[model samples]
Target: MDKQAALHHFKEHHFTPLLESELDKLEAKFHRCQAGLISDFKQSFRDLCAYILSMQQQGLKEPIGYIHYSFLRTQMLEQSYLYMVEAYSAEWYEDDSDCKLTYDASWAYAPMSAMLENLEQQRKIYMGAINSADVERLILESAPFFHSFVDSLVRLAIAESVQSPEYQAIHKAERLLIRTGEYRDISENLYVWDQEPLRADEVFEQLMQSSEEEPYVYENLKSLSLPHLHQFQKDLRYNDFSYSDLRGSQFHTCILLGTRWQQANVEGGSFQGCLLSDTDFRYCHLKGVNFSEASGRVDRENGLRTPGLCGIRFEHANLDEADFTNVHSFEHAYFEGASMQGTRVPRIYQQHWKLSDSQRESIVWTE
Candidate 1:
């Protein structure tokens, strides 16, 4: 489908009205506080949290829902901080001296604190499934609001001398959100290699010139042997690297989605923090390969329902510190002679696969 048509489909079918409804509710609550109709800040905060959770649960049911919900959640969080900054007065902080804000003789700090934590937890859960372009779009859409919100918060905190624990926590949360957005941008733009063929000497020159900050793309390099190469943080997605010798290659934080490494020799390669979801590594030599913090799982229940590590091989491989969280049918993958020391395999594998005692001992359960 064309780009416009695809976008329309997404907005119509996947993006639900429920998101906008919840956002409207939250905004109305904030407006009510501004009008001084709500004296109990804690009750308003509780209602805001309830709306956020309701939106999150709806997103958990589908991929498109999750994307829309994520964007709206960020906006709501910023709004919540804005409301708190506006509701409490400078005299309120000075009078307490204990950094606690109260309304109607009740502490009003716990709900806001809990809301920030819940937002972060949800972000982490859905991050791996999020598309790179979607992340960029969300960041762009929310940039203006986020900037203004932070500016206002900083000004308010300085004006009121609000160095309370709650203020500090909000500051930290804002910083984390900004940092995570930067990381997402970096991850999205890490692959930029030409798709042309060249002589062996030319290829070697390109590889040598590449660095982790500016990674070279080998997406079109098929059936070629590239052993002991330092192609760290490269974008090798949707390529056919089948029958290639890629032993000891550095692929840290690389994107390898839908890439074919079938029957390839990838021994001792480091794929730390790499995106390997839907990647085909069938019959490949993964001996001593490190997949630490690498994600190969699809959102099966909500998205495409793709199987993780399907038909992949780990014959005599070192899987130390590898994480297989949310991986589907991972037990179906071949693991003959593989070392799973310190590996974080998913619980689904244990219940489905009849693993040997030695194999069980090698793996560490996440739960």
Candidate 2:
């Protein structure tokens, strides 16, 4: 169609609304067209490109008074842009380089510059994904960028998890814990490289020695071998650790969903403000573990869940009025406001409780 005719048709058909209605379709079509740049699809590409440019030019600001959501679309658009470029690279033909490229036929940069920009963006996203919400999606979108991005994410996650407001008190309260002193049981050479303990100064020294702060260095140390690192690819997703010993470790506000802690010794550990849903702590030792503010020790007026035993083992431990809901065990467990539902404890421990048969059945074999 001629330009005048096309313009007339656009106006006549309510083009802007039509385009907006099919924005997703247009996006897909443009992505496919840009990849291959087939001659027949050029017009469709041009129209779509024009619409995006027009929208950008109109300066669409976010909703009124939202600090967080303003940055929300940034990550989404970034992810879309990455996929778009990757598609462009896969379908780009050399002969088309001489001609200006367009999805909507509006003028954009040259093909070479576009490719360069894509590479630059890929690098920037690789670096930024360390502390980004789109880290998971970005990792999935660009598997090639994994080596650079993964470690940064893992370290950042670890660092964030281990640093919380309750860290100081928890750490101080946990000093009475005696180390097994088994001398490095984990096969991953956790003690091999420089063997620097992860104190603040030590970590700072290591970080300063490197020009850039890359989190992968910690990942490498955690896994020592390529095979182990590869295992981490799947394992890292849910922090998938089952029947593991995570004792004396400090975890801050971290994600620990779907992790297995069966029969594990997490003694003297601190898990402040961390998400621990769907985690299995069956038969695990939680002695002297400071679950501060997490165990419902605070009063009900504080609007917190009441302490109820849940899926946790508390053998020979002191849980002074800490919250315990849906906990696993209270076998031989000691506490003040903490008693048992299905807890199998000694008669002396439950001397305070007047239990019915069903409530009594919750405990298997109490002392």
lDDT of 2 by residue, 178-296 (tens): 11111122111111112222343443344334322232232212211111111111112123232345556554444343343445555556554444443434445555454432221
RMSD in Å for model 1: 24.2
For model 2, state the Cα shift of residue 120 in Å. Answer: 49
State the C-alpha lDDT per candidate: 0.43, 0.29
Q: lDDT tens string, model 1, 1-367?
A: 5556554444444332322333334333433442242333334334433443343355421111010001122434333322221111123223222211211211211232333343334433343453435433532343333322222222112212222333222211101111111211321211112223434456657666765455554244545768876656666564556667788887777766656665777777777777776465655766556666676554423212233312244544456555665554344355666667767776667776555688899788875
**Each candidate's TM vs. the true structure?**
0.36, 0.23
Steric clash pairs (candidate 1) = 288-317, 288-318
lDDT of 2 at 269: 67
Best by lDDT: 1
Q: What is the lDDT of residue 6 in candidate 2?
A: 40
